[model samples]
Target: MKAVIELNEIKRDFLVGDEVVHALRGVSFTINEGEFVTIMGASGSGKSTLLNILGCLDTPSEGVYLLDGNPVKKMSNNERAVLRNRKIGFIFQNYNLLPKTTALENVELPLMYNPDVSASERKKRAMVALESVGLKDRMMHTSNQMSGGQMQRVAIARALVNDSAVILADEATGNLDSRTSYEILALLQDLHRKGRTIIFVTHNPDFYDYCDRNIILRDGKVVEDNRNKVIKDARETLKTLPEED
Candidate 1:
C-alpha cells in the first residue's frame, strides 16, 4: 500500500530568546493510506509540532517530509498551499465553523478556493457532505444555533466537502461530552471503514482503542509506534451508552 504521509527523521526547532527549544527530535513515521492512526502525547511531547508539519501548516527544520510521495520540503509556498487545500482536510477541537454562517454555507466555503468548481457544483457537493454526516435537515442552521455535537458534525462535513485524501483531526473531541465524544469517534470510524485516511491527535489514552495504530511521543521524539492488536469498535461502544436526553 502507498503511504499517505511519510516522515524521515523529521525535526523542528523554535527559538526562545537566546535558547533553542527542540520541538521535534528526529521523529520518523509512515502513515499508510486508509489507516486510522492516533498520535498520543502529553503536553510538550511535540504532537502539535508534528501535526503542523503533517498538515503543511509549517515546514520542518530538518529531514524530509512527504505527502502522497511528494516531498513537502521541496515544494514552494504556493505549491504547498495548493497541495494542502486539495489533499488535506482539518477537523479542530473547537469545531471552527463560522458562528453566523449556515451549515451548508460553511461547508461550501472550502469549495470556493477551487476555481474548477462552479457555484452549482459547490452547493451540490456541500449538500452531499452535510447529508453524509446525517445533518440534512440542519443545512440551514447556523453554527450558534446548533448544539456542540451538531457544530462538530458540520465541521466534519466541511472537511469532507473537498473530497480530501487525508483528514487531520487535532483533539477533535476535546470540547464534547463523553457520550458525544464517542458519537464523533463512531462517525470517524465509519469514515475510516470507507477508506479515508485519518490521523487523530489527542492526549486521551482511552481513545487509542479506536485506532488501527498508535504513535506515542515523548520529549519531541517517538517513544512508541505499534499496531493496535485489539481495536475497539466505536459503533458497538455507542450502543452501550445511555439514551441522550
Candidate 2:
C-alpha cells in the first residue's frame, strides 16, 4: 500500500496572551491509501488540532508533514490551495452546504477552484459523485429541502467530486441521531471499501467499528493506535469483542 500521509514528530503551538499553548506535541503517524481511520478523544485533547494540520487548514509549529509525498510546510499558498482542492476532501459535523444552493451547485463548488476544469466537466463529475452517495435525484433540491442524513450525503458527494485521496471528516456524525449516524457510518464504510482514505473524527465510541483502526488521543497525545475488534464492525463490538478489562 502506498503511503498517502506521513507525519514525523509534528508539533503545533500558539500564543495566548503571554502564555504559549501547545496544541499538538510531537505527534507522528501515517495513513496509507484506502485505510479507514477513526480519531477519538475528549474535548481539548488536540484531536481538532491534529485534524486541522492534516486538512492543510493550518500549519504545524515544528516537524514535518507529508501529504501524498509532498511536504506540506514547504508548499506555497497556491500550492497548498491546489493540494487541498485536488488531494484532500473534508466533511464537518455541520453539513456546511450553502443554504440557498441546490445540491448539484454545492457539489460543484470545489471544481471552481481548479482552473483547468471546465464547467460542464464539473457538472458531469458532480452528478456522478451525488449518485454515488445516493442523492442523484435530489441534486436540484436546496439544503432546506433535505433531511440531516441527506445533507450529509450531499456533503459526501461534494467531498468525493474532487476525486480526493484523503477524506478528512471532523465530528461528522456529532449532530445526527442514532439511526442517521448509523446510515452515515455505513455510507462512509462503503466509500472506504471502494478505496478512499477516510479519516474520521468521532466522539461517539459506538461508531468505532465502521473504521479499521482507532487512534485514541488524550491531553494532546496519542494514548492508543491499534486495530481493535470494537472498530471492526460497530455492531459486533458488543457481541464479539471482549468486555473492557
Candidate 3:
C-alpha cells in the first residue's frame, strides 16, 4: 500500500526565549492510505506536535515529511497553505468555528479559501459534507445555537467540505458525552470505510477501538506502534465477563 504520510527522523523544537524545548525527538512513521490511526499520549508527549506537522499546520524543526510522495519540507508558506487547503482537513478539540457564521457558512469557509472552486460548487460540496456529518438540517444554525457535540459535527463538516484526502483530528470528542462521542466515532468509522485516511490524536487510549492502527508516544518518542491491536474486541469481551464478586 502507498503511504499517505511519511515522516523520517522528525523532530520539533520550541523556543522559550533562548531555551529550546524539544517536542518531537527523532520520530519516524509511515501511515498507509485509507488507514485510520490513533496517536495516543499525555501532555508534552509530542502527539499534538506530530499532528500539527502531519496536517501541515506547522513545519518540523528538523527531518523530512512527505505527504502523498510530495516533499513537504521544500514547500513555501503559500504552497504549504495551498496544499493544506486541498489535501488536509483538521478537526480540533475546540470546534474553532466563527461564532457568528451559520453552519452552512462555516462549512463553506474551506472552499472559500480555494480559488479553484466556484461559489455554487462550494455550496454543493459543503452540503455534502454537512450531510456526511449528519448536520444537513442544522445548516443555517450558528455556533451559539448548537451544543458542544453539534458544534463538533459542524467542525467535521467544515473539515470534509474541502474534499481533503486526509483528516487530522485532535481530541475531536473531548468535550462530548460518551454517547455523542460514540456517534462521532461511528461517523469517522464510516468515513474510514469509505476509503478516507484519518489521523486522530487523543489522550484517551480507548479510542484505539475505532482505529486500524495505534501510535503511542511518550516524552517526544514512540513507545509503542501497533496494528490489529487497534481493532481488538476487548470491550465486547469485557461486557460478557463476570463482575467482581
- Number of the top-ranking candidate, with TM-score as the measure: 1
Global lDDT scores for all candidate models: 0.93, 0.88, 0.87
TM-score of each: 0.98, 0.93, 0.91
For residue 26, give model 2's deviation from the true position in Å.
0.7
- Residue-wise C-alpha lDDT for candidate 2, range 78-155, written one tens digit per residue: 888889999999898999999989999999999999988999999999999999999978999999999999999999
Ranked by lDDT from best down, the candidates are 1, 2, 3
Error of 2 at 221 (Å): 1.4
Model 2 sits at a Cα RMSD from the real structure of 4.5
Predict model 1's lDDT versus the native: 0.93
Q: Please report the TM-score between candidate 1 and the true structure.
A: 0.98
State the displacement of the C-alpha of residue 107, model 2, in Å, after optimal TM-score superposition.
0.4
lDDT (10s digit) by residue, model 1, range 1-245: 98999999999999999999999999999999999999999999999999999999899999999898889987788998898888899999999998799999999988898899999999999999999899999999999899999999999988898988899999999999989999999999989999999999999998989999999999999999999889899878888988788
Worst 10 residues of 2 by lDDT: 236-245
lDDT of 3 by residue, 22-122 (tens): 99999999999999989998898988788888988789989999998988888899999999999999999988999888999999998998999999999
Where in model 2 is the C-alpha error above 4 Å? 229-245
lDDT, model 3, position 8: 95
**Alpha-carbon shift of residue 210 in model 2 (angstroms):** 2.0
